[model samples]
Target: MQKLSNLIGLPVLETVTGTQIGMVEEVLLDIDQAVICGVLIDSENWFFKAYGIGFEDLFSIGRDAIMVRGSEVIKDLADLSALSSIYRLQDLTSKQIFTETGFLLGILMDVVFDVITGEIRAYQVSDSIITDLLYGRQTMPLPQAQVIGPDKVIVPDTMAKLLHAEQIL
Candidate 1:
């Protein structure tokens, strides 16, 4: 399982010309559908801002860098402007987790996913405690999200523990 944080700042390389394009600034996700679509390539150019590319354009996502087929696959359109309003991976942190039966679980710490498929595999729930660094915090694996909303995330009651954040280790 790979954490979403690992993709940040990874370099993007074009395979056709074998040229370095830029680094991955953030992973673009489809929140409602709960799928990672692509990445926003970091750029320093004044005229050209972030270069966005979809997963279909990717040759491979590797340990070293993100590989693309060519420059043509990159998108610089304004269509993605509204994506900023959508919830991102960063927003998941500290978001309350609610059960389908209406119960608060804990703060979401990290998400685990399949590297090849870009599917969210499991959630690592935590207490957000500094002492958790030394002693392990109680965790519950949320296999999938039932609903992702502006203020909170809902997972099936069966998947997560009933304990609250303050109750966990």
Candidate 2:
């Protein structure tokens, strides 16, 4: 498992030529499906357009970098329809998370996902900055049902009872 936020700024490498194509700028996710759609690669050049690589096109996701089979897998974000409608990871942060019964739980902090399968396993949430600094963020398993709206995320009410606060040392 990997935290989606950690992927940001990691190099995107082309395996065939061992060239560094770009850095991971953002992770694109299908919120309703709770799966990563792909990533946006920053070419770091004003003359170049950023590219998108679907999760399926990745050769491997390593601790140090993300590898692609070759430059062929990289394409203009406009051309990658699978990522067209997805939300960037950064866009979800600070969005209020609520229970089905309308109880305010917290806000989205991060996502724990399977690096190999791109499946979202859990969500790290923060009630407030003070709570986060004292108890750390709470981690909750992906609920059976989730609704992502323009301004908030709603999960099953049972999630309120299941959230586990991370121990801060």
Candidate 3:
């Protein structure tokens, strides 16, 4: 699978028409499944203002080409809310994770997907020290954590306190 970091900042070009679509800004993952469902495109105008464009107006016409429906190209527009939700991220290996205290926990190992709901259930952490200490000779699933932002996943202080108190096992 392609890594998210590799795709980020990469220029999205149109193969058929040779028109440049835009660079990927952020990737939207299914909260329940942790799988990437769409990508957010950078649609700031030449003056660096966000132009709001709806997803319906942006269609993928070719492998690399994304065509806007109207006469105005994205670069000329100033509103950007609609363009923000149009692109979807296809990969998910480079998402970062951290502890509530701002400690580096680990990178995302994989996303658990729920078949019935078709969403991300939990995130898998790949830290060897934490995994070995917590599981201890048995395999256990990664702890279910909350995503606080696009770049931050936080285990609540209450949950962290519980885990520290040995109440969660």
Candidate 4:
């Protein structure tokens, strides 16, 4: 799967019409599903904006292109503003994880998403086996997984407790 950051600057192309719509400014987060919801775009045609095209008409697009089953392209420019208000993946990385017993686990390092559903599948810890193989022992994996906000990812209390006890190993 591609990292959310990779899509940040990639041009959003309309596969159906082969039109270059715009570049992705930010990815909207679906808090309910703990996954990416859509891409926010910047459609500032200088002349159009000068003639009073609103910002809302320039910034939002649907996730249809990212969906494997969808064929529809986002055509409405008015809905673009809604994307700016949605939570982003960057927001989730800032939250802390705590166990039911109130132990502090590590921060969220990454989110694993299912390609088919575009839903979050698991939490990847920085110090876990994968991270150890990639980075080294100064890191330890923490257990906590939940969505706190559009950008806030929280670790579940139950998992936090298990991790606190070192039972995850």
Candidate 5:
């Protein structure tokens, strides 16, 4: 698994032409599915609209760059219906996390995802920015989000032990 945040800023390369087209600006995440649907590419020109590549259209994600079969894989953001109106990684990061039973876990930090499938496997959380800087964050297996609202996310109550145990460890 790879951290989704790591993909940001990676160049998007067209394999057939051996040309660099754009860089990853952000990721479109389907929160309900716990998977990344596509990526938003940074437009090289200020006046040009940014584009996106659906997960299925990507050729591969490498250590240094993201590869696409060709430039045809890129499309206007509006053309990517599956990704056009979904939650983004930025939308969820820093959102508060709570248990179904109303216990506060921490703040959402980053997610570990399957590089090939885009499936979210785990979450990194921090009690606070201060604590995070001092002691580091905790990584917990995601049991699926029970609730995702504008400002907060709720996870299964069972995750409480998982998170707390990791803290003790």
Candidate 6:
């Protein structure tokens, strides 16, 4: 498991030529399916106008870098923003989260996801002042989280009762 935010900025190295291509700029997530499609690398070769590798093509992901088989497989689908569910963790960072009933929860701090399966496991949320003074930070179960839009996320109000401040620290 790894935090989605951490994947950004990791170097992408081509295995065949050993060329350091670029750093991961964003995470392409199929949010409706809750799976990671791939990563968007802002490549050094602007002329090529294309550089993205699917998760299946990734040789390995480590603390240092991500290894891909070769450059041949990297596609040039430049405008992935058109894809409705193309969720970039960086785009959602610090966004406000609330309950379906319009109760503000807090800001979205982080996401814990499976590196192997690309499934999001939990959301580490910073609580709003009223709740923060009571529970501090809370890790909401994935089932409770509902992304209402780009600006806010909603979790059921009852979701807060499932855990106390002691569990999160």
Question: Residue by residue across 54-126, what tens digits does model 6's lDDT show?
Answer: 7777888887898988877677656764587777777667878777788876687877778777777767777
Error of 2 at 88 (Å): 1.4
Error (Å) of candidate 5 at residue 45 is: 5.5
Q: Across residues 1-169, which tens digit of lDDT does each residue of candidate 4 receive?
A: 3345555665655444667656666655555545566555555653332121222232332343322111234443335324544455566554555454555555555554544455554444443566456654232233324446443345556774343212121
| Regions of model 2 farther than 4 Å from truth | 44-50, 79-85, 166-169
lDDT of 6: 0.73
Candidate 3 residue-wise lDDT at 78: 28
Q: What is the Cα-based TM-score of model 2?
A: 0.86
**lDDT scores for all predictions?**
0.67, 0.84, 0.43, 0.46, 0.80, 0.73
* Candidate that scores best on TM-score: 2
Give, for candidate 6, the lowest lDDT window spanning 10 residues. 160-169
| Runs of candidate 6 exceeding 4 Å displacement | 47-50, 128-137, 162-169
lDDT of 2 by residue, 115-143 (tens): 88999888889998999888888988988
Query: Using alpha carbons, what is the TM-score of model 3?
Result: 0.37
- Candidate number with greatest lDDT: 2
Off by over 4 Å in 5: 45-50, 79-85, 129-135, 164-169
Candidate 5's displacement at residue 25, Å, is 0.8
Superposition TM-score, candidate 5 onto the true structure:
0.84
Superior by TM-score: candidate 2 or candidate 6: 2
For model 3, state the Cα shift of residue 115 in Å. 18
Indicate whether candidate 4 or candidate 6 has the larger TM-score.
Answer: 6
lDDT rank order: 2, 5, 6, 1, 4, 3
Q: In model 4, how many backbone clashes occur? A: 6
Cα error of candidate 1 at position 41, Å: 1.5
